[model samples]
Target: MSSLRSSELDGDSDDSQLAAKFWEVKLPDVVPLDDLKAIEKTQAAEVIQRAWFSHMDKIIFQLLKHTICAAENCVTHEILKKVCPSEAALVKDPSVQCKVRFRFGGKNFPPFIVFKIFLHTGGHGNKYFSGKNTLRPSSEAVVDACKLMGNRKYYDQIIQDQLQFQKYKVADEVDVVTMKDYMHFTSFLDETPAYLGGKSNCWRRLSLENFPKTMIMYDIMDYATSGTLSDRLQKELKYLLQKPKSKEMHHDQLRIVSQVRHWG
Candidate 1:
């Protein structure tokens, strides 16, 4: 009888905890700008400045959240569940499906993009945003920083993986046999979020012997969006697809490849 009573109590406790976890909990929100330090109402561009700073804070929080998640052992889906389990309901909603299709251009984009963006921007330090020579800075410096904030390590890894994938293609000589590993490589990206450290070393082993054209296309498409060798790839694919392609395309491909090589 004691054991039965203990089991009933444990069941009730579990149900209570689950209920608590399902609801929203509030915490105190901090204000970075104190009353005295706040922007003056008469100051030039005061409202615009406030709005801009507010947006910056939002971006910073977003970057911080992704960074913390990336450093965690949990999978991307698990992270989503912890953050907002209520979103689970959307899985069965037709409107949610329609939105997903629209957002990904009629197809789903693998979650890797989100992972990549988070990892890229979560990088520590101000290397991406140093002012140009101090006085009278150029807009280019700021833009370059913003671009770097999302285009460094993620780009490099994708490019290296693509090169390895292409090497297998060239070695096999036959389009069919040379690209077998392509599916596994691209599927890895499509299956797991990049921030989860899902791009494993095994990805390098993908070769023409294991994959097909559909898989090759998937790999190419993902690499193309990675912005690593995108410009060179865009030009190369265009040239190879074009009949009597332009010399400019050839030159640009060479230029882009050379630039990346130098960067390495």
Candidate 2:
């Protein structure tokens, strides 16, 4: 069995059940909120749950993509590397300026992580040029090749300037981040809805006021650039433990042949 480490951050002071959950991902260590609290509160005891709820509701107010993405970048003639997509910016200020690519299979697996573009390569922005896991044989080859080919333009523009490169990686190797962190994920507690993916959007909100893990698309891109995938290895996702707490092995997928064991 995989032993849980202090790194799991399970909100438990004692060690009993594992902390690092399949549905729970450790977000990149970003700056925590400075003297920030949930905008509102409930009549319940001053518990963390109530605090989280109040914070989430307020944060989602400014999180409407329609308000930010649609208005700012379009009017300012400036691509704010913050909230992107929906005809908005790509990456604003990323830790890794280069877009990291991983190979799992076909087109469904495009460059999984696209690093945000920093306005300048200085301070925290320098991770693209320097960092652990940033050092790779393929990346060096690309740089040298561009130099030898006399393609200083593509090299300088994309590689040096944009800090963009598509390195070969895998899901199990590097981090597999969603566009945002949906904190409302309830795996052990809520199983049926988990597979349904019905309230996925509802569960995922860009509310960081209370839940710092809640990220907008822009925030995610920033981490993609600066973050390195953990070397920690595990079983293939398709073979991992699933809900209803299964012990016996079963077919990977369902079809005709076998009669339903747990039918709704």
Candidate 3:
């Protein structure tokens, strides 16, 4: 039996050696450093180009939003004619002054035209209107104007873009609300007295003038009673109470607890 066990151990060792050799032969080929770097560079360039295109799209939308009359008669026909002659010719009615809606992007624009217009028309720094050059049209704006005049179907596209812009604006407002505004709302909810056993009208009656004092008092009470406070609230309280040098510093170090004593 011992001889059989020794033979089994030798067979196990041989199997392990074969497995190691198999892995050594089947290893994946290593990519060259130069090729890897080239791939990374191509990917980074694509990302940069996409970001640039998105930014330019936003700028074009803003320009169109401001310039377009949104009425039936093409009021800005003269400006459109100068910016995009080909597109201006396609306007529904050139005789009457009314609104013109423009579409932008894809094969409609000439190479480097957007950049040229952006530079000359002061589309940089988000200041489309600088000094006396307020109404100057950029190449992108021209291309967009052309698209609008050439295709009557693009009104829906422009409306969608406006909605997208408004969506982003609302998202930004929500982000702002989550910060200081949210804190104020929470404090108001906590302190305001209930009317008819409902807290709905508390917000309407909240006094902005007394907000600071109320917050300070609540912070002191919370700390003294060992009540849990969120990190943001604690930080705000610390600021309101002043630093370690202030006379209110001792309030943070004190805690009160109730205990019952029984007499036999």
Ranking by TM-score: 3, 1, 2
Counted clashes in each candidate structure: 8, 5, 6
**TM-scores for every candidate against the unseen true structure:** 0.17, 0.16, 0.24
Worst 10 residues of 2 by lDDT: 252-261
Question: How would you encode candidate 1's per-residue C-alpha lDDT over 32-149 as one tens digit per residue?
Answer: 6664355454464777898996764453333223322322322323333433445434433444431111011223322222221121223442221113112132566645655765
lDDT of 2 at 64: 27
Model 2, 1-264: lDDT tens digits are: 234654454536434444445457778776445522332343234577878866643433222221233222222112222323431233332443432111112233111311122234445532212222343446976567466657755444335322211331211113334432222222211222222222111112222121112212233222233332212101122222232133223222111111122222
List the pairs of residues colliding in candidate 2.
81-92, 96-225, 96-226, 98-163, 98-164
User: Which ranges in model 3 have alpha carbons more than 4 Å from their true place?
Assistant: 1-3, 14-27, 67-264
**Candidate 3 residue-wise lDDT, 91-185, digit = tens:** 53445332343322235421111101111223333222221122134656646655766655445534643553365432112334556655554
